[model samples]
Target: MKTLTIFTPAYNRAYCLGKCYESLLRQTNQEFIWLIIDDGSTDETGKLVDSWVKEQKIEIQYYYQENQGMHGAHNKAYQLIETDLNMCIDSDDYLADGAVEKIIHFWQKNGNKDVSGIIGLDADQHQRVIGTRMPAQIKRSTLFNLYNKYGVTGDKKLVYRTELTNKYPYPIFQDEKYVGLAFKYYKLDQEYEMLLLDEVLCHVEYLEDGSTHNMINQYRKNPKGFAFYRKELMKLPYAGQLFKFRQAIHFVSSSLMMRNQYFLKESPKKGLTLLAIPFGLLLYVYILFKSRTVKHV
Candidate 1:
């Protein structure tokens, strides 16, 4: 069995998928499988992947499903991955040179059942680290604490044990396509800490169509998903009052957008949600205003 599955969730990204494929082709180690979860791409992605599959430079698996947004694709990837370890490299992102080799070697040296898997850094296309590096003194951390406690910023590449990832499936809401991916990670943090690797494993490029660039529109269009994510965050034991309140504010705004009558009743922290009404109302109006001008590609 392969030691790792580097999965990519692509949607109408045929133009950029070749760069991702080229990076995988250049991997120094072939101990990993490339799994592509095609989230309803109408482009030539299927044909491109088929051609690459025939070349057989590395193991490749492809699955095509209805467009379910990034989080939905993540759910599908986690369910399909049977490898010992797995990592998500976005369609616009690619693995660093020798990244697979580094991951396998680090895991063999320190991987254990007590931990979920490894957490590594992500670099930009210019090869600059995107955020702060893991502290030298800390060798392990829960995904939540790493950012909340240590003040780490920006996105990091997470390699998870396939078995553990399967246990926490991201919730799929009807007519909603976005959810905080941290929903599953925070739940896992309750049970296991992940080993931290200082190595950079993936190179990221945020395109115009990427989710990060269209969050305001996402908040407006995916209110239910946002509300559900906020409710989940509110229930987290490790989450501080400020964090929970912030989630509550978003929850209220999203609930308003959805016009859910039982917003208060459904909230884990009803009192906080009630207290956040004014701020949430303002945010709701802001989202509406911003979304009107924003074009979701």
Candidate 2:
């Protein structure tokens, strides 16, 4: 069986998908499959993958599906990948040279049934480290604690055991919103610890068209996305009401501080920041003013 399956959910990313394909072709080891989910691309992405399939001498499977969100494509990838280990490499992002070889070797050396998965570092398109390193040891980590305690950020840098991930497929919601896959991975942490590879294996590019860079408007307009995340967080075991309430405050406060429209949309509906109603809007406004002052100063 293939040891790894690397896939991307791409929509109209034909121009950039080649970079991902090229990186896979350069791998020092080839115990993997590249599955590209052509998430209803109207562009020539199908032709692009076909061309790459002809030129590249690796295991490549290109599957197309109706445009689901990124999480939807991920749901499909998890269902289709028949491998022990799997990862989702964004079409705009590519792996570091020989990074997979290193990851596979690390897994060979350290992982077993007891360990759930492996986490790696993320770097920007220019290969600069994007987030902090994984902790040397994570004691009592939950999904939120991974971010809150271990300081692990960025939804992209982790790899998972296919069996465990497939078991917990990302859920679809009533509207077009869902909790992030990172939350799902964190929930998995309740059962297993991820082996930290401490290496920058993927180069995450910030494309103008990419979801992270451009989805603010959609998320703002729909707003249900934020509700989806809040609901998921509250559902966690021991996600106590007090803790949830406190988290709700922090979340909206942070969003207001950042002027993230999604949270701005959420703040009123969920009454998330209004627990301290008299000063809540003032606090948000103050934060915004302070940020602007700091930036200008």
Candidate 3:
């Protein structure tokens, strides 16, 4: 069995997925399986993967589902992954030249049950590290602390254990197609600290057509999903008061958007949510104003 499963949750990205496929073929270590979750794309993505599957140049398992947003695709991927280790390489992203070799080599030498998985670097197409490299001094830490406590910034690559990833499933809200991916990571942070691998694993591209708030629109539309995600963060034992307050602020904003009168009662941090209400209202208003501005522009 392969040591790593590289899963891509694709939604109508047939145009760019070829690059990801080509990169996997270029891997220095061919010891990984590629799983593609086809999230109800009305594109030629399926036919494209079918052609590649016939070539047998690499292992590819493709599954199609009704459009479930990113988190829904993630839910399906976790269920289907058979490997002990897994990583999400976005449809618009691809592995670095020797990413598979680096991941397997480092994991085999250092991986254990106590650790969730490895946190690696992500670079752009130009090969510049996305945000900041992992702190060399810290050998292990939760994904939350890596950003909140250690001041690590930008996007990084995450390779998680299949067992742990499966434990926290992102809930599907009615008519809502989006949820923050960090929902699962923070849940796992409660029990595990990931091993740090400062090597670049995947290269990412942020397409202009990808988001709503910038995907800000995602928040305006998926209020239930956003409110649920923020409330969960408020309950994290490892997070700071300030962080929780910030989450509360967003929670209130999303809840108000939800038009759910029982938001305060449903909140995990009631007092904080109360304090955040005024600010949340302001944010809610700003989102409305900006959304109109976008439509006009």
Candidate 4:
């Protein structure tokens, strides 16, 4: 069996998905499986993937699901994955050359049951590292501490063990599509730290239609999902009180947007949630205003 499964959650990305596919074909190490989670694409993505599958170049698995947003697609991928390790390479992004080799050798040398997986780097189109590099001194850190305690910045690639990724299945809210992806990462942080691999693994380009580009619209439209995510973060035992308070602020904002009256009662930190009410109200108003003029990604 291959050591790693590189999964991509795609949503109508036929235009750029080929770039991701081409990058995989260029991999120096072919001991990885490419699993594409087709999140109900209306475009030519399925046909394109079929063409690649017909060529029989690399191992590929494609699963089609009704439009369930990114988190639902992720839930399905975790269920489908059987490899020892897996990491998401978004449809619009592609892996760096020899990244599979780097991860395999690094994990073979450094990995153990004690660690969750590897945390690698992501570069921009011009090959610049997307945020500050991982802290040089540390060999491993939880996803939360890497940013909050160590002052590391930017989006980093995360490779997780299949077992762990399967545990925290993100909830699909009634009509909402987004749940903060970090909810699962922070949950895993409570149990394990990820090995820091400083090499760039994937190159990312945030297109206009991507979720990162439309966070505010997502927040406005998916308040229940956001509220659920924020509440879970507030319960993290390893996280600092300040972090919990911040989550409470967002929880309050999302709850208000959803018109959930039991928000204070539902919060893990009721005191913090109460204190956050005024700020949350203001935030809700700001989001409502922003939604009037902005378009959803």
Q: TM-scores of the models, in the given order?
A: 0.98, 0.79, 0.98, 0.98
Lowest-sum lDDT 10-residue window in model 2: 214-223
Residue 121 local lDDT, model 3: 96
lDDT of 4 by residue, 1-297 (tens): 999999999999999999999999999999999999999999999999999999999999999999999999999999999999999999889999999999999999999999999999999999999999988899999999999999999999999988889888999988889998898999899999999999999999999999998998999989989999998998998888888888888898899898999999999899999999998898889889888768542
Question: Model 4: residues >4 Å from true position, as ranges?
Answer: none
TM-score quality measure for candidate 4: 0.98
What is the per-residue lDDT of model 3 for residues 129-163, given as tens digits with 9 covering 90 to 100?
A: 99999898999999989998899998889999998
lDDT for model 4 comes to 0.93
Question: Following a full C-alpha superposition, what root-mean-square deviation does model 3 have from the true structure?
Answer: 1.0
Alpha-carbon lDDT of model 1: 0.93
Q: Model 1 residue 222 lDDT?
A: 91
By lDDT, is 2 or 3 better? 3
Model 2 TM: 0.79
